[model samples]
Target chain A: MSTTDNTESLVQLHNAGLREQGRWRVRGISLRVRAGEIVTLIGPNGSGKSTTAKLALGLLTPSEGRAERRPGLRVGYVPQALAIDAAMPMSVDRFMRLSNRLDENTLVEALESTGVANLRHEPVTALSGGQYQRVLIARAIAREPDLLVLDEPVQGVDLPGEAALYQLIADIRRERGCGVLMISHDLHVVMAATDQVVCLNGHVCCHGAPRAVAEDPAYQALYGKLSPALAVYTHHHDHEHLPDGSVRQIDNNASPGCGHDHG
Target chain B: MDDFFVRALLAAGGIALVAAPLGCFIVWRRMAYFGDTLAHSSLLGVALSLAADVPLIPAVFTVSLAVALTLVVLQRREWVSTDALLGLLSHASLAIGLVVFALLERPSAYLAEMLLGDILTVSQRDIVLIFSVALAVAVVLLLAWRPLIAMTVNHDLAEAEGQNPVLAHVLLVVMMAAVIAVAIQIVGVLLITAMLIIPAVTARRFAARPETMVLFAVGFAVLATQVGLWGSLQWDTPSGPSIVVASLAVFLVSLAVSRGRHA
Candidate 1:
């Protein structure tokens, strides 16, 4: 809690809860994201991961406690899934400019950064699953937001693509120095890059450093045997595959170390 | 062309130009049924206009807007599924309109004219009204274009990125209500949604960007109006139905062309 001083905190939730239709979707949730930090939310379905994300993004006001954002904070978000109807013809280039008007250089740079520059003019409907996810991320970062919130950033991708995506997210944090809040169900893949993991089952079951949460009994009960696998994934990945098919060694000193407190 | 035909063409063209962009969002959001609901409610607007002896356009706009807002509120409640709620409102309004028409002792021919619009009977004043509303709608759409597209792509993404998706949604609904109110004179309650949907879907085959799709939709809609009006004059057919049929023909041809390209 005392970590709130030095770094600029982007969004903070204090015992925040959302009530819908006489039911508390999530309750007693406390979370924070600071500049250049990554916080991931891991939970099963109907556990209010999305609702919690919404509250943090100020999309939904908490019915009980409070959610606050830095004044004039610019945000970039990638939702869990975006099914662009075939009836709405949209190209990757246009989709990137959906919320803001970016100059040609900024647009191309964002696409290039995500390694989807080749697909800039391609129809969004024609993209492969991995390609679409990259384009979504590219679109979000093009705004150069103060905070980036991604909901299940790798929903339908293959295993290799999921790891690559997590790596890409980590790289984005390194480059942009923006705060990141991610929601993921893939604990094994997401835990590698996540600094903090809040495990939720209708509420915050356990939350701490990824390794700490992975060993928590509550997290083990919720995720069962998956926690051990997550521990191994978090412990062993000293390197990651970049989007350009290049392998990059993780610099423990510079990069957000795998579940280790930089403090 | 006779004066009446000119007025009809001008009015229909204005409505088409505005409706096409809104229709793209409708198609993207898969709100064809929502459009149908609003169109159906326009019948009740007609009834109210008749009952109160007030101006038709404002009455229709008011009723449609009210119905749209009610739908928004009801959706938040989640007591009933969205499709069921749509069906309930759609049929309820239509039945009420019919009953009210009967209670007023209006002739069946008048009711028939309302159901199957008499575009050739549009007055100069009606043309003025249509253009005014169309201009207003065009301005709002231009201003709201990015947010609307962003929301359609993903509502949560739009909201999290500091864009006002709810405001964008409300603005879109209001514009739709305005278009439906003005369009009721040309296409009537029964066929108004056709003007909003057919051209947008047709435009989907060729467009590679959202803006291109909107442009293509406008072109298709205007072309349909012209072709439909000409065909009606040549064959003594119902003008509104002729326009819808023309748009349907365009859509079918686009489908064939797109299928052939893929093959």
Candidate 2:
């Protein structure tokens, strides 16, 4: 966790324990996200990444531990599925006002910041994946939240859209200085946007800078077989363009079994 | 030409105006079953009203609100699946209401009227009740429109922004309870869920935003009410079923039209 001088620690998960269906699922998970740092949790499927996000947001109380969010800190969250009924006519402008706090100028600034200003009056249901992601980001920002948590914001988007959204998130962090926590499997995107990385596999396997943990032994052991498809920021300097319009850089100098691309 | 048909038409119009917006959220939140749960709880209200000799609508509203709140609270605890909770509460309330109704010795007319609404028997007081409740629901919803939408889109996100998801949810359930109480007197419980779901679902085919969807649902409901009343008068059918069928017909036509547009 990167600590900034100005902002206090917003979230402290002390040895947090969470249970599912009366069974102990996550044990002894401790997390601290200091303000103004973008922390991304990367894990394989069923690794409790989503649960950690929910717990931090106070959506679910830990079964045997504590998730203490600082008093009155606003959180902006974007879930995996955009599951909006497209037929329901809601414009981005109207949706942002739902928090009932932000004034018009702030709302417009948020929309502009997320690059969703031009799409303000358009029906959110008709937005493309990229535009929809942008709208959700704008919705979160309109609240002027102290922490922004996104669960797979770039799940189904094309590479370009995913890249754009990562850039948008980076911009938001820079502009607002809000602490961001993203749960993602996209190593490249998270590495590009986040300052700290927490690798979870039901429990946190490692937590530190993206590059260090990317080469960590635990990650290599778990993702060694699926390295080609899963590795986000493979440090391979041998750059080769693939058929799917993505370049693969296989880093041979670092670890033997750790080579991937940033497509 | 008959007075019965004329009265039923007016009653349907009033419900169409109110049920449209409520139905939109019900559809969006997958609370089609929630309407059923709330409508069934009206039986408890009916039983209590008779047992205590209380004014019917207010008593029904209170009891239904209790049941609705219970469902909301239970859902928050996540003790059981939402569907199971809804099913349990729905049948329990309905069974208890029936048992209470059976135990009380009285003229069966009130019970009959509540079970199968006598739109033709609608008194001036009933019209007044519909008008007043409709006004209250419309105003409250208009005021709380944005927050409600945000809550529906993602309850956790809504709560993160200091908007009380539970309160917003209760506000919706209470509004629904009021709508069901008013409508049960017009459409009856078995047919009431149809009134709430079909119009909104049909409108969803055409509407691109929440406001437009509600407007379309209201228009469809009004049409259904008018045509159903007319058909019942002309063909000697039950007014409630006739209205449902009219709404269903509109829905089918809308589906066809939407398909054609896409084609």
Candidate 3:
């Protein structure tokens, strides 16, 4: 939590909650995003990550809390699933011009930045998933919004593609200084790329930097049981330690029979 | 041109012009069933109009608006899937309208006209009414085009852009209600939805962009209306169903052409 400066965040939610069908979908959630920051919400299935993002976007009003935006702040959003029909018949260029009109130069630049400029005239549904996602990102970035909200942006991308997309997003932030809030289920690659992590399961479980949350029992319970094969950010953890903070390599003073640390 | 043909042309042309733009969004949003439900509810509007001795257009618009609003509200509940909710509304409203038809004593043609349509028998007042509503729907759609497209692309994304999806939805459904109101005179409740969906679907085959799709849909609808009217004169068939059949033929041809290209 980077001592959230109220005036800097383009959008913020305060103790927000959404109640539907007499049940709380998510509750008591608070978030703040400032310029050039990337906030990623991560959790397992039905973890309220999307719900929280929606609340912050004011797509779902809170039954208990409030979501606020700086007046006249422009934001661009990439939703979890667009769900547009295949029959809608939209070209990538047309989709980019939906909310805001862009000059040819800007349009080409945005599409080029995302590496999809060649696809501007193609039907949107004809594009592959990776291309489709890149188009969506380019559309959002083209508008020069103050904040960009992306929900589960890398759902259908391969591992390398996901990394490349994250890199592209980081470039956008560096170039435009737009705040970003995105949702994802991936634990490793996302943790390394994002500045803040909000782990949620019905409610916020833990939120902070990736390194701090690695050893968190709540986060570990949710993700640690899985093998390290999925971990993209490797750190040196060859040495084990007890909960009491003692190095567990065979203490030669006490474990002579053990082959451990037998200098 | 004969006055009768001229009036039919004006009414049908007006409806086609308006339907093209709205239908594009409907197809984009995959709201065919939703459109059907709204069309079915127009019967309730007509029934209410006759039962209450209220004016036809306002009553129809009101009831359709009511149904659209109800759908929007129910969607928020999430207890019922959108498809299921539309199913319930479609059949229920149809049944209720049929009941109204049975109980009320209007001209024998009234029921048939409401169920199918009677563009050939439209009066000057009806023509004026049709054009007025069509113009309104077109204007509203033009004004809301940006927000509507954004919402159709992704609801949360629109909200994150500081747009209210509910507001966009309300505007869209209201425009739909207007089209339904105007179209009920030319195509009746049963075929009203066809007018809203068919042209757009047919245009999908060749249109590479959304706006081009809208333009193509309008052109197709105009051509379908002319062919259907001419066919009706040649074969002494119902003008409205003939129009629908013409559009269906176009859709079939589009399918074949697109399939051949893909193959």
Q: Which docking band does candidate 1 fall into?
A: medium
The candidate maximizing lDDT is 1
The lDDT values for all models are 0.83, 0.77, 0.78
The DockQ of each candidate is 0.73, 0.44, 0.61
TM-score, structure 1 vs. true: 0.88
Q: Can you rank all candidates by lDDT, best first?
A: 1, 3, 2
Task: RMSD for all candidates, in order, please.
Answer: 4.8, 6.5, 7.4
Error of 3 at A152 (Å): 3.7
Interface RMSD of each candidate, angstroms, one decimal: 1.2, 2.4, 1.8
Candidate 1 chain B least-lDDT 10 residues: B112-121
Query: Is model 3 an incorrect, acceptable, medium or high docking prediction?
Result: medium
Deviation (Å) of A228 in candidate 2: 9.3
Stretches of candidate 2 exceeding 4 Å from the true structure: A1-6, A70-72, A91-131, A141-144, A186-189, A215-263, B1-12, B77-80, B95-112, B226-238, B245-263
In angstroms, give how far residue B3 of model 2 lies from its true place. 9.0
Residues A79-118, candidate 1: write the lDDT tens digits.
Answer: 7767877877778888888888899999998898777899
Worst 10 residues of 1 chain A by lDDT: A241-250
Predicted model 1 interface RMSD? 1.2
Question: Per-residue CA lDDT of candidate 2, range B127-177, in tens?
Answer: 888888889999989888877887887777677667777778888988999
